[model samples]
Target: EADIYQTPRYLVIGTGKKITLECSQTMGHDKMYWYQQDPGMELHLIHYSYGVNSTEKGDLSSESTVSRIRTEHFPLTLESARPSHTSQYLCASSDNPLEQYFGPGTRLTVT
Candidate 1:
């Protein structure tokens, strides 16, 4: 498994707050994914990429955006956060499609 990390592991912000959830890995995987999950719910894929500058939206629709400028970093940003955006954001990267390493996850609360 790759060494993956997410900054500000837990966060609480007021409505309309702008926030960025950072994800990074040291193994330099070329494929990355972002998934969101509400407490006790199944994860929903919101974004993914195969490589730098190759971004694609996932199964779940989201108000957030992601960028992949480097192979090791993938950041998700909510330009104007709202209460409905509260959830756990998970970042995963893989060298093999069948196996992926995941970050600890960012638990966000928009109040």
Candidate 2:
């Protein structure tokens, strides 16, 4: 099993509501990432962090933001979500040469 975890595997909310997607890892990896994906679609990198105090936006554009204060924790937050934001948020981490391991994901919907 992968070491990462994401909360509220599914969520439905109204527009303009603040929401947070939790992500954590137990592998003590310094690299963490957040990706957005539609059902059965390819993953798009939304956010990533190299280590504590080092957060960078990914190649994809996203309204959500992430933070990496602790090596094992990286959380994504949306100050106000919209229907367009509806998608699956996946969390992943890598130690060295190994490929990233993914979390189950949070399926968020804003109506």
Candidate 3:
């Protein structure tokens, strides 16, 4: 089973609402990442953190932001949700480059 976990598995809200998606890994993995995905589109790596105080923006542009103050936690925040924000957000943690543990994705919808 995956060691990663994401809270509020699903969310729905009106436009302009602020939201945070929480992801945590208990395996003590130092590498964590977040990806944005659509039902039929490709996975886009939006953010990643190598360890505490180490964060880098991925090739994909995103309105959301993430922080990694603690090695086990990487939370993503959206200042203002919009209709276009509706999508699936996936979190992952890895100890090695070849394998990763994925969390139960959070599905967000901004009506």
Q: What local distance difference test score does each model get? A: 0.94, 0.94, 0.94
Extract clashing residue pairs from model 3. none
Tens digits of per-residue lDDT for model 2, 15-66: 9999999999999999999999998999999999989999999999999988
lDDT of 3: 0.94
| lDDT (C-alpha) at residue 51 in model 1 | 98
lDDT of 1 by residue, 1-111 (tens): 559999889999999888999999999899999999899999999999999999999999999999999999999999999999999999999999689898999999999
Off by over 4 Å in 1: none
Error of 3 at 51 (Å): 0.3
Ranking by lDDT: 1, 3, 2
Compute each candidate's TM-score over C-alphas: 0.97, 0.97, 0.97
The backbone clash count of each candidate, in order, is 0, 0, 0
**lDDT value, residue 39 of candidate 2:** 86
